[model samples]
Target: MAMEGESWPRVRAVLAEIFDRDAEDILPETLIMGDLGGESVDLLEIAVRLNADFGIPVDEDAAFLKSLRYLLAESREKGIEPEAALRAAYPHLSAERCATLAREAARPQAAPLLCAADIAAYAAAARK
Candidate 1:
């Protein structure tokens, strides 16, 4: 069964339940680690729930797992900061979204970059 529009709500609900919070409080942009009182253990639980609920493969070892800031810094270390690198790394995101992420990733004090939105996006992308 392919994930659909309902996936977002379901994803949010699953996170909410796993974290012992209300579903309404778990918005797409809510940071799982920083804002939701989630710990490292929560990451695995969330990934598991996402896979079981939406059939989305949440590879914790993916490049994006190190946070967008790490990705940007790592890319810069390689040479010639590429504009499409972000988009290429996260194929589920759009060009404009990639630009926004690149900017946010440059922030000095940015919080943990993984959010419910990422999980939702992964679910949507996995449907393809």
Candidate 2:
């Protein structure tokens, strides 16, 4: 289920343009915000560009992991484990990654683990 082929290049190009970084430096594993110095505004631009470039609707919340805190809160309210909630919300991420994200979500100052591959996966799924 890994995102590959066409979507990576297109997503990388979009990230490069938005972050003003070379496309070659924008690896699939590169953290969008942590590594590229991306901000909330950049994420908005990324979502907009992905929709326009691929002709696919990009759910900005899902793509950018914007609802991590909300999902965690909801899970707690519903008596569900944070990891389970994270996995349910982001099935494209590995269970291990989801667990890590769940732990990180507890720390308000922690940057999300979202990466270029995550965005590319969203684009690939949207294409289908």
Against the true structure, what is each candidate's TM-score? Answer: 0.82, 0.84
Local accuracy of candidate 2 as per-residue lDDT tens digits, 3-56:
566988999999999998899898988998789988889999998999899999
Q: List the global CA lDDT of all models.
A: 0.72, 0.86
lDDT for each residue of candidate 1 in 1-128, tens digit (9 for 90 to 100)? 12247768888888889989999888877887888877788878877887787776787644134546656877788874644677767887657667777777677787767777777776677766
Backbone clashes, each candidate? 0, 0
lDDT: worst 10-residue window of model 1: 61-70
The best candidate in terms of TM-score: 2
Candidate 2: Cα lDDT at 13: 94
